[model samples]
Target: MHVQLGVLGPVAAWDARGGVVGLRGPMHRAVLARLVVARRRVVPVTRLVEDLWEEPPADAVSAIRTFVAALRRALEPDRPPRARPRLLVTEGPGYALKAAEDSVDAWRFEHAVRAAGELPPAEAVRRLTEALSWWRGPAYADVPEAPWVRSERSRLIDVECRAVEGRAEAYLSLGASAEAVPALDAYVSEHPWRENAWHLLALALYRSGRQTDALSVVRRARRTLSDQVGIEPGPRLRRLETDLLRQADHLDPGPGGPAAQVWAQATAAYERAVPSDTRTRLESTAGLMRDLAVTGGGGLEAARRHRVAAVAAAEQLGDPEVTARVIGIYDVPAVWTRCDDEEQARWLVAAAERTLRTLPPDGHDAARCRLLATIAVESRGALPTDRPASGGQARALQAAGQAEQLARRLDDTSLLAFALNGVFMQSFQRAGLSPRRDAIGAETIAVAQRGGLVTYEVLGHLVRLQSRCAVSDFAGADRHAAAADRLAERYDLPLVTVFTTWYRALRTAMTQPPADAAAAYRQADAILDGAGMPGLRHGLLPLAELSVRLRHGLVPALDAQDDWGPYESWVRPLLLVEAGDTQAARDALRDIASPPRDLMFEAMWCLVARAATMTGDRDVMRRAATQLRPAAAELAGAQSGLLTFGPVAHHLQGLTAAGW
Candidate 1:
């Protein structure tokens, strides 16, 4: 049977059937509470005796034994005579309470706080909110204020403060600053000594457009810290105050205000009564707004609804151009290594194919080219099982090639740039393709500049940045990153910083210590999450951090048995080596097939090289070195636009030194 204990409020216990255990009198409750606070650790009788009373009677030990017997009878009424207690057991010279952590409200609250620390902001808010709910009143309220009880109560209060501040921080991170204000107001009033709470409250108020109130809060915090703690405000609070005074753009909630207005206008236009052709165009424009909304931290479900409506309207209109526009709405550069939305991609691919069938083969070459390019872009990251006999990559490349050929025949610069982007998306499927991608990026920039396409210009720079990073050309990468940032800022692009921020973090992870690298990755992830680009960084950040730790000879705190998709096959072998299971690591490495010549090939090879080195598998080392030699100048895994495994040169040197 299960047991439930509560210390977040008054000390209490309930059995499996929801009946109170009838802990009688102040002394009885105190004894049960003391055992509960021990958290299943043995507390010696002598310590309990001292904690329970300042003065002891001659029969105090017998009195404690009587209390224990009465508590056991009340807690376990079904136990047979002389049977041992399951929840409370005597161990050595003390008694221990053996309740599960989840059964105790205080323990569960602490667990949630710890778990919230590892999660993204939105999830962290939910976890911390639920944990805070477990506190009904003051902790251990019914117990007498013994020293141990007082200490435990103080610790719980500290944890509660952290949970409150953590929730507010998460809300701020998610741009729900207004929602965080009321709670933080109450929290700061109750716990004025917490500088972080004061900072968050002030920031939340400022973000909610209460600048005067925010300034007052900061000033009040300065006074409170000076008077209460005899110190100045911390660096973060000081910086926040300066930024507030200057009205820094970074202090603004998000850059979504303008995008939100555009979205509203497009949405209104699409819903009006209009001609079929105009309506189709309006629907397509609305679809673009939906994409903007998603990239600007708006809800995903609304974007999906807009997409579906636009696709249906275009198809019903029977206009191939409108259909193509709706199908190719995702105009960003295709840099994702994994398929984010399979259903959406499949739908767009099928729509493009159907529209192509409707157009005459000889004429409408531009429409055909656009449709072919859409197919190429949407066909990215498709699994082999989803392809026909020609294979997914082959099919995508064929479409891209045909589109580029048609664009050149038409002598249209914009169309050619679009077609080249399709080709780049398909061509970037494998490692050692960085040189090819670099050439493509260069041509894209030239063509976009000739046509004055700002969006495409930014994309061109981003592509070059990614390719340069892959090749470990940090100087060249920085140039392209600067170029892209300039264009993105001038054009007011909403989510361009997501890619740039990730690249910066990836570069840091390659060059910095593991802890610093992890922090950089986390900062980048927060930006990505706040931009509503979860699919771009999903599962990749943690793996990136793990790779950094592993490279530094530190064992990562990850479950090796957990499935990591394509990363599982290689990571498992490396994890085995970390576990000191040389034979197991060797066997796992042997079972791994030749690394597929895909985006992850070099990264997987680097992991295999490390495992091989640790296991002294000279044959595997030789194979890994041979496979990784072509990309020796590249950072392994950076080509995937996600993460990196430092440099391929490092792995090659390791392989050579390991007798490869």
Candidate 2:
């Protein structure tokens, strides 16, 4: 329990008595090394076995267990001369080291990394400078080759990249771009494929008045990646390059930064290339590639090329709906670069309109029909509040209705299955917690089952919506929970695949208070642990926020800056839990409601308002009732089965009087 964990230098662990744990055995030690590197979590025994031996020996599990037992004994060394909990524990289905994470070196490194993100520029530099000092050599340096090692090595590189990025950011913040040169250069060199890294380096160089140097650095990076990966620099990165080149004076930030104009040109070019209507290999590939470029970590030029190709294919194939959906997808990146919000909205709405124009009177494919539905949903929901654009909500409503009609009429199983999902959205909007709404949701399930298209991505969405409904109506979300479990089991879906869906479901079950719902959460947490994605990890924030309060009996305050709040708050559906602080929760509701709209935000306000009043706050109770009256009214439509954990809705409900 008191072992000196060292992730700063070759990952060391020392016993309480100060003896070095000899992680020195040959292959067995290698297995231990992999486990240690991945500490506090399971490293699939099979994966470890694969690493220790190219072809695992016949008794691989037995051998792996033996190594684990040995590592545990060596690392733990019974401090009290009794069977104290070993340093490692058999967690879930895999072996895990239950080291008090703070005692581990990797945790120390992580602390440094985290501290940098929190501190002022000077403090960040100090923190990261210390963290970077912990790296003695490439991590797992002596660990023998193993399957887990490949992934672990990649993780180590990622950690290093973060440190570099942090240091560079801190330097930029402090007006010390010159100091960041070496770090950025080194990082860019090591991670030639990283667009974000390239962007920071360019920013550093340009900010330091090295315009030519900045431009040259980006050009070099693009060329290097091209030679290495057979791809051009990514769109975001290429935009940065153009930014560097277009600057009249690098020191003076010049002329409508290139991201918008270049992206527009790229987009318009693609749009011009393609025709309308129909899906093909080229069209799907192009859309997927551009989506990846927009939301993914891929090459920009390549994404542009794919977009152009998609456009050409769409035009050649002449599918109006395909062109529309592809354009709708483009709307996101367009806005990111400060493109006109109205312009993006116009393009999105246009897609739906065109889809409507071409959608067959009774087509079974449902591609255009579905796209029309999604466009309606996102466009209406995403409309910037600064200027309330007209017709988005109307279009969304119309599209939803039209899609419903088409889905219901199309009897083909696959198309019906797809169309049923659209109907679920439309019907959910029309009648919350009503039998009709639940029936539509159920039908979606039936269609999915009938079609045999119950991928977790599909099922997760369905279950999440159903779980929401279950919460709204105060019904057990168990059926939907069961459905999720079956889907996961049937497909072997990775934890992340259905993680948010499961999280929302569990949170809803917890809304009842003191009752742990199901063992599903353990499985859900396991999925998140393996995800290694920042955004996905953000989903755990609410659960973390709630679980810590319930377990510790800590009085939650109204302040938004809890330890986990920063990590999770930015995601959505604002939550206002009363950690014995009903006043704080009330205040929190006001904050959540005050910020913005989008169904997700409004939903959170409703929930927070509900919680605040329950804990005390009569005025909050009255206000909540006032706010929730309409919410309840709205709920009858879009949200049929009250999904309790839709934090925004809860906030709004909390604000309303129960009868209101």
Candidate 3:
């Protein structure tokens, strides 16, 4: 029998000719995500169901078979070489997909990452060059309902920084200094905190015979790192600087690879935003200009060049709110050249508050709404919810409504599209049905269809909303996720695409073994990487920490800085305990115990369950469980994005494995 496998980018099946195929119904998408992540290995039918339906129906087994059958047909559509290697396989108590390491996106990504690390300079460049070609955008952008697949996408994204570093290094090693500069610069621009890219960049410059320029680069990099995030360069980069100071090398270098395409895309975006002063053009340019304002070290001088053009464009655009919004993206990490987080915060707050106060009573209102929303989100902790003076939640809604109203008035698709996205974000903080969010999210799926809006931002909000609807009131998180995934794919926005899909798959996947969760984590990590938000970018802290604790024993340290310190301690230990390390979990629980603070209650109960599970201690675990039960109940209701409930419920089960 022909079997179809999907462990990379959706459960895909094709004949020898590479034609698109279909799969069976019910949980096909969920099953496809699993196969892609698992990469054709035999995943138990039970596991497939769990990855699909969180609380599965009695007919789950049949559902799995139906999905498998659909996959086979999809892969076997016009089989000539027979579907054996063309699709998936049925084996043991589960199914085995036939695609090899190179066939799946996950496998392809791992292969690329590995090749980049293992290959020599020339070959490394060659291998990575081949690898990057695989990313059309976010992995499996068309299929967004699978947690298993989505997690894999996140992992792929996390490696993006590393991959860029590796590629640039390879290019430099091959004496392609000038060619490597733009990519390295882009890397530095995106991750202000990461030092490796900076180090590589300085080296590229120094070797390229810009000794004076090289020294300046190092100084600027050092200043930015020190000022923001409160740390200095790690040892490795410092060593590179010492090397640069003493070094002398020939500067002849070759041209860039296809990453030129990316620079092209960014350039095109810049070009699109320029040559116009109308609100239509200005609104379009706003995000791109914000992109330009960022700083990357060398290559395209991406952030610098773009920011200059953006500034000029913003001036021409001349709407206060638009100016403020563009300025906000620039201001958040503002550094005319070097990064200054303190300065960034200063500008962000000033621009945000100023924009809020000066919002025109009757101007490009959609642009104004977007500006306000961006400010609130970017300056998140700085402006607490309890204090709404700086146009917090309530103001955001009013702004969104007004923006939508203006869009309707002007019949502007772009403005309306932006307004709709703002509505989605505003509703997350506020309650009730919002016309802007609802009309656009469900109604205008096609409008935001292929990255007409920012995919990551939209997915981040929509995922939460979808989960809210599925578990609390609405039908499912999948609809929002499904649309988001398509956009992520089209735009190559990884994590945002996955956020909507991960938790929905988790409902089913969570019931499986601890290893399954690890697999799930890997899948989720891939997409989260592409989301490009620092918070989502750094989310691995919790998932990985907990997964390890669950799978292995937690080794305590005399020092507080062991890999676990930076994370929320309560949450990690709970996942670990639930993963089955009850004793070690208890130790962590004892250490984490603090009287319940406002936000810590949810996290506190997680630890409590773990400790209680180890000793079969009822009182504390029960209390934590009872207190957490409502939250956990809420999670069971959740169908997508970062749910507190799944992990909480899992911990509760750890406390008392009986009911589970």
Residue-pair clashes, model 1:
0
Q: Compose the digit string of candidate 1's lDDT tens values, residues 1-660.
A: 377888888878889888876888888888888998888888888888999999977787878888888888888789899977777778789888787667899988887787677555766787788889888799989888888999999999999999999998888766688999999999887887898899889988998999989989999999988887799988999988898999988777352356644644665685675554685565556556544543444334335546656777778887776676666554545555454566777787788889888775677787788788878877876543212214766778899999999999998887888888888777744457888988888999999999887777877888888788787787898898888888878877757777888778877877889889899988887775534444565556667778778668787766422336556777778888887887889899884665544566688889888899989888878878877887888888877655787789999999888777
Clashes of 2: 64
lDDT of the structure predicted as candidate 1: 0.77
Each model's RMSD to truth, in Å? Answer: 11.4, 20.3, 22.9
Question: 1 or 3, which is superior by TM-score?
Answer: 1
Q: Write the per-residue lDDT of candidate 2 for residues 1-660, one digit (tens) a residue.
A: 577766444556677777787764666556656666776677777666666787777998897888777767777666455554456666556776666545766666775575456454665687678778777777776665556776777787788789888888777766677888887788777688787788888888888778888888888888888898789887887777666667746433322246534644664686677654436445556556644442221133235445545655564456665665554343211101011233444554564566557766655245655565545433432323222223455555566677666656666554454444444333323213234545655665666667665541344344445435433533444446556566656754433244445545445444544334334454555454313233323334454444434333444333332224222332222233434544555555443323123323334334444464565555545654554454453431123121233333544443444533
The global C-alpha lDDT for each of the candidates, from Candidate 1 onward, is: 0.77, 0.53, 0.52
Q: Give the TM-score of candidate 1.
A: 0.58
The segments of candidate 3 whose C-alpha lies over 4 angstroms from its true place after superposition are 1-346, 356-366, 379-413, 426-440, 443-483, 495-508, 526-532, 539-541, 544-633, 636-660
Instruction: Say which candidate scores most in lDDT.
Output: 1
**Tens digit per residue, CA lDDT, model 3, 440-499:** 455444454444545433533463455444345334455555655665566554334344
Best by TM-score: 1
